[model samples]
Target chain A: MAVRVQREAFDIGAEIDRLRAGRTSVGAVASFMGVMRDFNDGSGVQSMVLEHYPGMTERALESIVAEAGERWPLIDTLVVHRVGELRPSDPIVLVVTLSAHREAALAACAFIMDFLKTRAPFWKKERTPAGERWVEARASDDRAADRWQEGDGA
Target chain B: METAHGSVRVLYFARLREAFGTSGETMDLAPGLCTVADLRERLALRGGVWAEELAGSRVVRFAVNQTLCPPAHALSAGDEIAVFPPVTGG
Candidate 1:
């Protein structure tokens, strides 16, 4: 498993390929990408700056990936989360999981992203027409992460 | 006991950083300030904006030594404490 928290943009295809390199046991590859948007909270967002705690951000991602590994029979995983200034359509994060079958790969992919949304230390400050304002944590995101704890993975 | 030796590096992030006017500082642990909540309460006791931002009704999060923790988490010398708003990342 690899977790990269960097300011530079990441190539999704390359990351997935790296996980599958010389691994024939992997039968499934599931991935998810989150991108920056131009509009939020009924306003036009001009840009956004992603802020994160230096050492803690990496530890959070690694811990989330480790949890996913325990929940599924994952062969390999890659998580790339971008920090710094971003504009519309810029990719913000990527999560990919490999497994012997689709079930584990797909569930683990969703689980990783869901947990990352709430647990990761990064915060977003969006520059809108009004002014630069920090985005508030959404209750929906908490609910999304909490659902995984209810029962077996769907 | 060398209570004077109990100093920690405290960090503030995002909005907290902006409001506090500094990113971080080294704090000499006050007497009896043994928990994260106690530290916050002590800071809040500073009054004015310090009280408004940290001591008010607003909710903030805490992390001890780079890992998230509850308010009651124990504090020690050399610990790295972080205070910030809730996380909004994916």
Candidate 2:
């Protein structure tokens, strides 16, 4: 498993190739990418600044990936989250899960993103027409993360 | 940078950073400040924005030494405390 939080942009295709370089057991690859949007809360956003607690951000991400591993049987997992300034259409995150079957890879990829949305320490500040404002935490995200609980009847 | 003998570092992030008007501070350990909740209360006692942002009624979260921790987690000298609102990143 690999978890990375960096300010640099990443190429998803290259990342997948690098991770699955010599893994012959991999049969399924499920991936999810989050992109920056131009509008939010009814305002036109021009740019965004991602903020995080240096030491804690990486730790939180690693823990999330670790939790994903505990819940799924996998060949490997990669989580790459971007920080710093970003524009609309910029890729924000990428999660890839490789497994022997499609079921494990697909579910684990979704699970990792759900967990990252809630558990991770990163925050976003969007520059809109009016002014720069911090993005509000959504209740929907909490609901999304909630379904992953052990006894959560999805 | 200077190090204090009996102090805990408190960090503010995101909205809390703007609301509280500072990024971080070195607070000396106090007699009654024993847990994360206690430290929060003491900071909230500053009233106004500090109280509003640090208030328990708000959706606040805490981390002790980079670990997300509960309010009851004990505080210690040299510990790093972070206070922030709920995360919104994807």
Which candidate number would show the highest lDDT if scored against the true structure? 1
Q: Candidate 2: where is the Cα deviation over 4 Å?
A: A150-154, B1-5
User: Each candidate's DockQ score against the native complex?
Assistant: 0.86, 0.77
lDDT of 1 by residue, B1-90 (tens): 545457999999999999889999998986778899998998899887779888877988999998999989989999999999999987
Candidate 2, B1-90: lDDT as tens digits? 433248899999998998878999999987788889998899999999988777658888999999989999988899999999999898
lDDT of 2 at B7: 88
Tens-digit lDDT track for model 2 on A56-151? 988998998888888889899999999999999999999999999999999999998998888889999999999999999999998988877869
Residue A23 of model 2, lDDT score:
93
What value does DockQ give for candidate 1?
0.86
Model 1 ranges with Cα > 4 A deviation: A152-154, B1-5
Residue pairs of candidate 1 with colliding backbone atoms? none
Worst 10-residue lDDT window, candidate 2 chain A: A145-154
- The residue pairs found clashing in candidate 2 are none
